[model samples]
Target: MITAKNPVHAALFLVLAFFSAGGIWMLLHAEFLAIALVMVYVGAVMVLFLFVVMMLDINLERIRQGFWSYLPIGALIGILMLAEMVVVLGSRYFGLEHVPQPAEFPAGYSNTKELGRLLYTDYVYPFELASIVLLVAMIAAVALTLRKRKSVKALDPAKQIAVKRDDRVRIVSMDAEKK
Candidate 1:
């Protein structure tokens, strides 16, 4: 996956990763997450990326120039992640016997319902905070993107609506030019 020269190939690998993740979610019985993964990554994001990659004239050599320079840091992060995973999974340091377990689900228990309940109850504050953060981000984006460009002529609706006939046109009496 590393050293993919073309953006298209990189996008294809991303799509493959998304599909694999979706399949993993399915195996975990998370229908909503799996479906969302498929819809968002496979259906929308990947398609958009493919179109962008195909349409835009990209300078691959320029992008690849700093690859080697950045590799060390990336390799360091990868190693740290690997170490963390090894600590979490490959080691029995924090065995299940030491941790408290939740009550077993009832026979007809639905993951969706449980998730909803947890979201509205235990995780409500964090969820609300996330929504507020997203709202602020959206407002900030709008404020940033919506610049009053001095070069472009912009009309105000109130000014246009309040216009009188004299404000727009005037009848003038001038000597006619006869050839």
Candidate 2:
């Protein structure tokens, strides 16, 4: 029985289902679509879900507080979004009488290779821009959390390297005759 209490397990189940479906799609020769679904939804979206569930300290009471107030608006937005998606999908059936499928690539050509080539060649600028954006985001995240504390002692690598053994260690033998 699937329940809300075990969201991580439920998400894992969903991820497995998606991966299985993607494999089936690949077997059916829809490699592009299967790879997209697996990479975007399974890899990115599901991982994000797992990370959020694991990392965030969720306040159930705060979430519930505005539920009643937002119910109508949320429902209305959801219905509108669903209607839009239905219309957009249905238009493909009604408007397009017949769309020609591209000829299959040669047996030697790989789908993954073709996708990589396209991303690197045709979409190079966009790909580079996306990478830069991600780099900036990473830097921003590090900057946000990074801080220096006066109370904490920090190791200086140069100082440690420069120190002689005698500065840090000592060995002594005392004469027993003095006692």
Candidate 3:
């Protein structure tokens, strides 16, 4: 019996609650970590979830028709994702080398400051590339949504600009009819 309205409101409330707690966490000196978590999850992931929910229509029966057909592919994708996570997190277990930790900083050095410095100095190119990729994606999305319809009457802006006011205006006067 759960409807769309209930789930949408619940998700909005959850996101609001998360941001409220995150703001408090930031005040408690975990500013960078808290903001990053909020930005990545609440900002990006939640917006993506909302976008997909609003854009796509789902029919349970139609979807269920292909459940068995896609089960093996879905399972394979899931296993690959899990395996990738294990490989990334299990580096120590696999005897891979680790970078030596830097010497402890003085009291004034903040984690956020250090992270920013590293990102700007070492990862700046990759960061710029990511932004360019996002821009291209946005442009592609806009282009995909734009279509020309033959049946619709559309105005040409260039023609409008070239037109004189007299061409579009007409004046007429009506007098009482003679008995």
Question: Which digits, one per residue and each the tens of the lDDT, describe model 1 over residues 1-179?
Answer: 46689888988988989999999887666778898999988999899999999999999999999999999999999999999887886567764444322345467777788789999999999999999999999999999899877899988999989999998998999999999
When summed lDDT is taken over every stretch of 10 residues in candidate 3, the lowest stretch is 95-104
lDDT of each: 0.86, 0.80, 0.75
- Candidate 3 per-residue lDDT, tens place, 81-159, comes to 9999888868786532443223444668687997799889999999899999999999999999999899999999999
Clashing pairs in model 3?
Answer: none
RMSD list, candidates in order? 4.6, 4.8, 6.5
Q: Candidate 1: what lDDT?
A: 0.86
Ranking by lDDT: 1, 2, 3
Candidate no. 1 TM-score: 0.77
Predicted candidate 3, C-alpha RMSD: 6.5
Model 2, range 26-123, lDDT digits (tens) per residue?
77566887989999999899999999877878765765676678878988998999998888767967443343234545657666787799999999
Measured with C-alpha atoms, the lDDT of residue 104 in candidate 2 is: 49
Residue ranges of candidate 2 with Cα displaced over 4 Å? 1-65, 92-109, 171-173, 177-179
Candidate numbers sorted by TM-score from highest down = 1, 2, 3
**TM-score of structure candidate 3:** 0.55
